[model samples]
Target: MNHFTICASKNDTHDIEEGILDTLAQGFVVEKNDSSYLLKSKGLFKRHQGAIHVIADNTDPDYFAKNMPGMMSFYHNIPFEDEQLKELVMIQISVFNTVIAVEMDKEITDEQMQLLIKLLSSIGGVGFLPDGTLLDQQGLVIVYPNGESGPSNFRPHACTKMINVQEATSAQGEARKNNTIAFLVEKGIPYVASLPQLPSVEDCAFKRQEDIAKRAVALLIAIQFACDVAQSGNIEDSREFFLNMLHKYNVQQFLTDNEKSFLQAQYPDAQYPDAQEAVSIAWQYEAYWTLIWALGFVETLEFPDDVCDCDYAIQVVSSCETFEQFYAQIAMRSKEEILDEADKIYRLHWACVNSRINGQAAPLALNESVVMERRRALFWMIGYRNEQWDTMSMDT
Candidate 1:
């Protein structure tokens, strides 16, 4: 059987090709043929096929993009003493923008496989097997951006397990839940086992409490303005009211792209928002709620089985006149507290996504939109991936 490996890289095609040649030079005589390479073993007897075809291109790896969250979740389960390295791998995986295809005419030997992995890894590449296993250049070692690597115990076909929450019998449902929890726990991710658990405050890297408070206030003003303009059909008075609030809070610089776009669409000659746009703008309330919770405005974020109370949400922000007053009322939760919630929501969000992919109702009464928006807020609060507010990825 022919063997194939898909690799993702930050390097261009030429550099990756050179890397392949350099890596294989010790074991084989390599000849470059355009994008392909031909190899002959230096040993007396060849162990496998002598020819390899490579195709490198500048394109997003669709499989990686679609399954990234699941892959990262898998990696996150692996234990790493260096939290920074763990995070670095996540960030590097998120930004890989190129793909390389390595093909052999026959199944590769174990030795040949290691060579291929080494070549890819030398160029800061990630490998994906046909069975959905992700690997570093050193076979199973998870490589860091700075050339350090850690052993990985990730198993193949782990991502293919699926459960239909609505169809299973009570016994089967319990089994599935137990299996899922066990799997996560064995992988060193215990946060998903129960109600969200906070890490120690010392372990968290949090934005300044005051900064979080300011952001919450700014989001509140922007989202509320959007709600009003949507309710008033984008009238001049509504625009004036929003502008006045922005001036009052001096939060113009903090508006997210979505908020700015919604406002811009309401310019004097612009059209009123369509139903989709209006709903999107309104849903920012959930994100706003999460920020307030982080800022200690909300007592606790109840399970997201329902949308947050709009009237109560409005009351929370309106109670404070200025940003300073809102900051004053803030008893900002510890970074550990917010991250714990974020981690729990992440797993819950994954279940929701898994259900959708399987054509079933969202499991555990999860409101998919609420879960997603809440995650978006929590992720932003913790600066997950250091992404901008509008571009932040809520990878399950």
Candidate 2:
């Protein structure tokens, strides 16, 4: 069919029809004829026609079983909270009880597409383009069953792709390496100016800036509390303090299992953290340092050859009492800047691993632990592998 189609709840048929007519009436003279609407643009020779067809008393079983699964899989790649994602799924399910198909006669103009999007938002509808691309109610791209998406005018792809880091001599890999070296040199980090790059910002799917900012704030609070628990050694008081901080920031759900384990060790009945645990948790300072830099709290992230300045790291977060206060201070670095750093760090981490395997000194004074920790943070920022914090793979 050479037209645009959208599916919404049958319950919204009246509002959908009324909304489309009212909106089109502003630019096109609209007339109702039975179930169809005919339109003629004012002061122009253009004309268009459309109709709303409601499929009553039944849901599209194929839509629920086939399409929703892929869409839900796509949502898993997004970094939103579980509850938020669940709510989005529920909204789509509600609209599926009875379907209303909206068909437009002419090729959808950008203006008309936007109008459709508004209608979808009003009733939690889903859209299907002639080219087979799917759109959620918010007009965000959701992939089809085969991992393909439509409407080339929208985002280039609906899913993120993994870069083969080992294929350094391949076409994309070569280009990435060249770009990485140039970016690092331009930004004044020239130590690894000779390393190969993995992927650029445009090559990867990134979380929204607002979401990343919130994640950074939550991470900073969690890490700071973890550090305090490590230092105090008083299990009872530190556990209360750490839990209070998590509640205060409303970030109880953001802690990874590793963080939870470390915190749990501080419980009165649990095994007390040994010297080794303290040292390991202290290394999280480097990760926290990277987060602050990404959030623009620090203007620069110095070379990761040594431990980060702990006192300064604590002070930066301690100054912000509320989550909103801390979030307000964030002027997140650009995607290009963050991706460049991630690329550089990824290569540095490989070098560190290679050195250890070969029983040689780490190249360019690189500290394997520091580089690994910073790489984890950078990779998370760029949505590398889309893995959770503790489970993030650091494959060289």
RMSD (Cα, Å) for all candidates, in order, is 11.3, 18.1
lDDT of 1 by residue, 170-220 (tens): 443344455546644664433323222222334334567766666776777
Residue 257 of model 1 has an lDDT of 78
Whole-model Cα lDDT per candidate?
0.63, 0.61
Can you give the TM-score per candidate against the true fold?
0.59, 0.51
Q: Write the per-residue lDDT of candidate 2 for residues 1-396, one digit (tens) a residue.
A: 536556554432456567657666665666776645665555354455566554433333444444433333343333333344334443343234334455656665676667667766665556666655567767886644344443322311111111222222446556656776675466544222223345545566676766665666566655665566567666667767877887887776777677677666534465565656656656767777888888888888777788888788777767888777878888888887887688778766655665565466886677889997898788887777576777666653
lDDT of 1 at 218: 71
